[model samples]
Target: MALCEAEKTFVLHGVEENFRIDGREREDYRPMELETNIVSHAFGSARLRLANTDVLVAVKIEVDVPYPERPREGKLEFFVDCSANATPDFEGRGGEDLAVEISNSLAGAYRSPEVFDLTKLCILKGRKCWKIFVDILLLECGGNLYDAVSIAVKAALWDTRIPLVKSVTVDGNNIDMEVSEELHDCQKLDVTGAPIMVTVCKIGEQCIVDPSAAEELCSVGALVISVSRNKFSTILQTGSGSLHPQTLLECLQTGHKVAQRLHDALIETLVDIKPSENSVGFLR
Candidate 1:
């Protein structure tokens, strides 16, 4: 629906020369900005903008009974909402499809316990545990939605602080717990193995990572690859176009390589982020 045969051929030739229309390498990700603790109401929060695509992630913590199956583990849930500001079509339910897609992708990425440790969030064996609610808001959609959302979610989880438990008491059928009242009495979430998703769009005959809006429109097909600590977690086919077996394999390998680089760069940038520095949301 987006491209003519001539345009597709033009994009293919560009990829063959290792020179994309946007002048980025086949493995290069777009520029991104990240900020933590933006929403005052949430326990932890972060906002990420990848070129024109903007995503916000907020973490909310609540006390709840441990699940019967996992009495010692916490719960992690994802909710995604598309904002009207992204496009006029997204004014209401127009963006529901996109929101569902993003949320499902995120859920799949975090499904593995090895990627995120929920045991640490447990308060008592069967009594109280912390449930983390990660709400994602799509403010814009330039391109590469999965990558931007994963990065933001990881950053927000890192910034999240769980309140320190001061005391816990369990009655025969009831439980009571007292948490630290001090605002600063909190613990940071250990997010060392969080995964990052990298999308590679195949245009004409070549594949490129982090496609621009125009590039996305021009691509015949795309693959979404999720990586955690250099390991593959999930791979999804997005666009309607199909790929040959050999090309699909090559694309998966390229995705792993690019995803690792992106993850490493993100860690470095996050560690380097200073609390004292000013972060301009969209203006910059």
Candidate 2:
């Protein structure tokens, strides 16, 4: 409803002129701020804000027996909860539908063994394994929810530290594992292969990255694509509209390029993070 036929034409003209309705280039990403270790109760935590959309992620670990088939592999799960702060309608179960949809999409993205190595999380075969619970909280909804959540989740995972197991002993159905008491004795998750989602908003004939809520409402539809390094992880279509094949492919191309840049930027930021520094979550 935001874009009538005449207004759509104006938007198309802007895209053609290399200036979008929001006065941004076609490939420009919205400003993002990331903070880690905001939650003391969780093993790892991160909060990210992209323009207006904000999300928080926390990782928790639990002990449980390994599955019979994959005794050596541990468990990793994803859960998302939408907070009322995001929207008044999301006061209780109002946001559950959207939360489930986002969680399911993320789970599908990480389902493949190649995406995340759960096997490395196993401490003892058929006896003990670490179960990781990733909880995502949606704090605000401006636009580009998928991208913000993905970035926050990845940063949280990067900040996660797993305790080191000194030794594992099993004798006559009794198993004892020795864990390091030193707080410094921990290992970080290898998140190099983690994928990032990039959303491409399709207008008349062009695609824009990180569209704002107003601009988003003006779009006909959008595509959500997750990419890791140079590989395509997952591609999903959202919005109540259809895309042509060629346009879809073009949107994917845009998504890939944006995703690559996003991934690289995250890695650089994480690598440059000083261990002794403190995070400023939502204070700034």
Candidate 3:
């Protein structure tokens, strides 16, 4: 995101007045579009568009042994792929750094047992468990990539349906399990405690929740806060600028408030989503 001095000044002034270039409030998010089950082949899938930034999340499940240390817990992995279609800069391996950063951030946010329960994924004590693979694809870069990715991830997980184990028989060391043949006899994951990330960008002593491309370029410091069930899951400082202790506290407070609102809004949106007969991947 490149902006001239005049453009930067204009954005700064707008933020100061609490009216962004798009006429949104400082703590308001841009228009967002979310759809679930976009990828029929995957176990669960969702696509979210926050203004121009677009992200696709797909959840895949497999049977695997649990980790030795965490015997009773299942495995959850996050993989981020930044496609070149988003930008030429991500053509080859250019987006590796950003991808890794986003994936790591997501891993940290979902690491807590309170936020997400991995034990529910365990079929047996330690012999068999469901491994969840969350694959995120970045299709565009408008701004606030982290927030959009997190929202899409949560929606995908909510849409995921785990197959039910009808019967499990253990013959000595060999164990066999039978999954239900009925398609509708599946269990939906509980995503009530999933985290919602909010990016708070500080521009001239004021903090903004969701910033645009031009607004991001003008910000000196930023904070990314992930809130789960009214508590903070992860908090990180982004950008090169430094902030005072008082300012940091203020930013955290703002993030907490904004995250809760975002979470509530997301839940309401999810409830309003109806199963559509037609799938709209990107055409719409």
TM-scores for all candidates: the values are 0.92, 0.92, 0.95
Q: Which window of ten consecutive residues has the lowest lDDT sum in model 1? A: 275-284
lDDT of 1 at 242: 86
Q: lDDT winner between 2 and 3, please give it.
A: 3
List of clashing residue pairs for candidate 1:
none
Model 3 agreement with the true structure over 72-115: per-residue lDDT tens digits: 99889999999998977798899999999999999999999999
- Residue-wise lDDT of candidate 1 within 194-255, one digit each (tens)? 98888888876678888887788877788899888778888889988988888898888988
Clashes of each: 0, 0, 0
Ranking by TM-score: 3, 1, 2
Residue 270: error of model 1 in Å?
Answer: 1.4
User: Model 1: what TM-score?
Assistant: 0.92
Alpha-carbon RMSD, each predicted model: 2.5, 2.8, 2.5
lDDT (Cα, 0-100) at 209 in candidate 3: 86
In TM-score terms, candidate 3 sits at 0.95
lDDT of each: 0.84, 0.85, 0.90
Better of 1 and 3 by lDDT: 3
lDDT against true structure, model 1: 0.84
- Tally clashing residue pairs in candidate 2: 0
